[model samples]
Target: MTVPLAATDFHADLDLALRLADAADEQSLPRFDAADLEVSLKADHSHVTDADLATEQAIRDILHAERPDDGILGEEFGAEGVTSRQWIIDPIDGTANFLRGVPLWGTMIALAVDGVPQVGVVSMPALGRRWWASAGDGSWTATSDGARRLSVSTVDSLDEASVSFQSISQWAQAGKTPELLALAERVWRDRAYGDIFSYMLLAEGRIDMVAEFDVKEYDIAAAVPIVREAGGRMTAFDGTETLSALSALATNGILHDSFLSLFRDLPRA
Candidate 1:
């Protein structure tokens, strides 16, 4: 499925997103495993680190000077302005993994026009990998040998699919553990390859499906375009095309409906 794009070119915005990711990586990598890394809890009890704050600030600084008129909605600092064009950011998508020295964490950046993501960049400096895409352009990943365009796998059957459910605890908390387990039993394999990496893997054609609960827009915004541009499909679990649903179900375009049918009757958030 094609991602929605305004008449304007997205190349410049996508370039800025890449630069923002670079800045985020610069601010975050040094603090990855540092003994002095400060960690704290938000009111909701989720962990936040000094690196999360600093990295987001670095990205914001650049946006403020480069695209001062665009709005900003960031995980750390909250919303900044109100406009049709907005930059959504999650400086450290997997802060728990980051603070624990796991190499699975990354930075997420996206430019949404009228609430639809048109440009996206996900950077995993710890893993030396980055994936990006703009609406109409194909998804691509930077590689040592140069860059490779991305495409989803051709797995068309649930029994043959490899799925990533993100976290079992999330399903349990959402009261959807039974459904998750049922889906897991049907899939060829199931794993909780949490965070944005799961979506990236799906975009790269290495995984067939990814579903998760209790996610914010920033968590999935930067992934929508990449997945869509890579010939995959992403939407809320209930089959609606939206990021505000607080849940996500992404799959190879061929398997999207089959995956959605599993959770079709559940009440949305």
Candidate 2:
């Protein structure tokens, strides 16, 4: 049966996004923890596999038939329309974890209007969790018990904050490791939460900040709503509306500006 994903209110869209996630989970979860996969390197050497392609195709097919007017930009398929109202999807946000059976992977889908994300959903089926948000009604999450609203932590001081990073190799390759390392040094603590979950935690107020370089639109688009709707700030390291795919910083709103200053001294190499 096809769930229409027809929602009229903010919470309704949240429900629909989650329902879309449920559909996604049904297709992807059974394939996880599989011993054999046709994993291989892409042109840039980032890992990809049959799961990524098949999951994306399933989501794309649903969107195409359900909301034909809406555009879509997927990790596997190229852009499908010329409209500002577009859906950005990363069928599995942490492919590495998915391939390794790490249970840290999740599906990501976002609705971006004129490049601004207004709806976001992240579903980690293996972990049995999901989070979603709309532009106004606020961000939220679901667990085994029930759903709950999310709010960023009130940790006002960077010296007392914990920053969740994406990856060391990602930062090093972007030539921004020095700045990233310095930021880590300034923070009270750091951990590599890599991929969609870090920002989701930021939304839930469990983590104080996150920064990373070398990301695709699909990597962070769905995450923006979860963060912003929770009252955190997400943007380029320098506080721009958007940076090229290589740079981003997300923090509880209070830490954004002061935190960006820590990057002023990133030594060029």
Candidate 3:
């Protein structure tokens, strides 16, 4: 049952992405609130456990069987096969939250059309919520028990915006730490959502902006469409149309150009 890549109808693909997210949820939710949050650290200084690997492998198997023709790029398994229309997966996006019973953790899935994500899904089983959007359908959030629409806030100025930056180290690694600090100086407030959820909050209008450096394709691929469709904008530091693996900025539409100007000259702090 290979999922074909014949220019997926964004609406249909977004629906399937959420269903795929459900499959991941089934594998992750029970372990999420486990009595013991014990975890083993990876050599790279990051963390992973059976839940992360298992959830990702389970998703890969489903993608392999359900969309054999479609390619996949995932955090746990790396990239596989060929197709411009690949599905990006971050099986359990905030292991720290999952490990600590924080409930901000979630799984991300997105269908990239010729390298641009056109359908995105983010599901947080512990939180009992999920959000999704396609190129044109707009973003939405649903709980295991209900439904609701999500959109960014109308905060137009950086001084009024509620923003989240994934990590301080992420920007430092890219030599954008100074730029980040400057932006921080201007914004209302900030926190580190550290993964997919920050972008999710941005789309839901709960957070106004998110910028991160040193990320891979799987990290931001799934959030682009959801944010864009929710009346927001997402692009690289240069304000390009394409979402890059290196860096990304997602902002409510009202703050797009104004914020881009911040990146014009990297500050030295």
Candidate 4:
């Protein structure tokens, strides 16, 4: 006889994601700045460290044992299983920074149901912080101080918004340098806080917007739920809800349209 499983228990799933993140942290933190850490390049020429590999493997092992039926799509190991319930993971979101001893890197874990992300956890052990959210549960962060709810900034106008577009090179490479420059000129402030950190800051109400190019599904999947649950909006640069989009744009819900409008006339590559 087969037993019926709990029906889409988001809270329980979120708890599991956090536990996976904890395991990731354990695998990553010890190698963060290790002098002997191994580094290599992927087919795309991007860097990958030992920490990235080990962390993803650790998370994958847990998922294999605990949630055998769920699918997994990971940056380091590629995809496994085929199911509506999928776990998307980026064991180390900022490997470049992590390799250089920068504290801006983190591990990202997310669960998607029918292709819609319903849970997310971003853990930055080096920064002493982590953020998590699940469908129907508000976004939250844990710091040395303690855990607290998170929210996006209230700034409603581009002139008053603080934005980060990851990096100018990304826009330049995407053939949208002029557009990016124009946006920086229009926003109240602009910084290249690049990577998963920018979205975390946006979710914490510390920044107003984040847009980036050349992102992958694993790069933005975990961020979707955290930003959305924190009362923000995230979409492709063309203003569609898709993680596979080549670009990503996120902002306080109020400023989403205004931000999208800036790219309306630009041609996509």
Per-model TM values vs. the true structure: 0.96, 0.91, 0.89, 0.94
For TM-score, candidate 2 versus 4, the one ahead is 4
- Kindly indicate the candidate among 2 and 4 with the higher lDDT: 4
Clashes of 3: 3
lDDT of 3 by residue, 239-258 (tens): 87665547788898799788
Each prediction's Cα lDDT score? 0.92, 0.82, 0.80, 0.90
Scored by Cα lDDT, where does model 1 land? 0.92
Give per-model CA RMSD. Answer: 2.2, 4.7, 3.8, 4.3
Instruction: Name the runs in model 4 displaced over 4 angstroms.
Output: 1-8, 265-269
Select the stronger candidate by lDDT from 1 and 2. 1
Best-performing candidate as measured by lDDT: 1
Give the per-residue lDDT of model 2 (tens digit) for 182-261.
Answer: 87888999999988889988998889999888788888888888898898999976677762445778998888887877
lDDT pick, better of 1 and 4 = 1
User: Which sequence of candidate numbers ranks them by lDDT, best first?
Assistant: 1, 4, 2, 3
For candidate 4, write residues 1-269 as lDDT tens digits.
00123345598899899999999999999998999999999999999988899999999999999999999999989999974889999999999999999999999999988778889999999998899988767899986778899989899888999999888789999988888978988899999998999999999999999999999889999999899989999999989877788789989889999988876855566
Cα lDDT of model 1 by residue, 98-216, tens digit: 99999999999999998889899999989999999998888999998998999999988989999999988899999888789788888999998999999999999999999998999
Give the higher-TM-score candidate: 2 or 3. 2
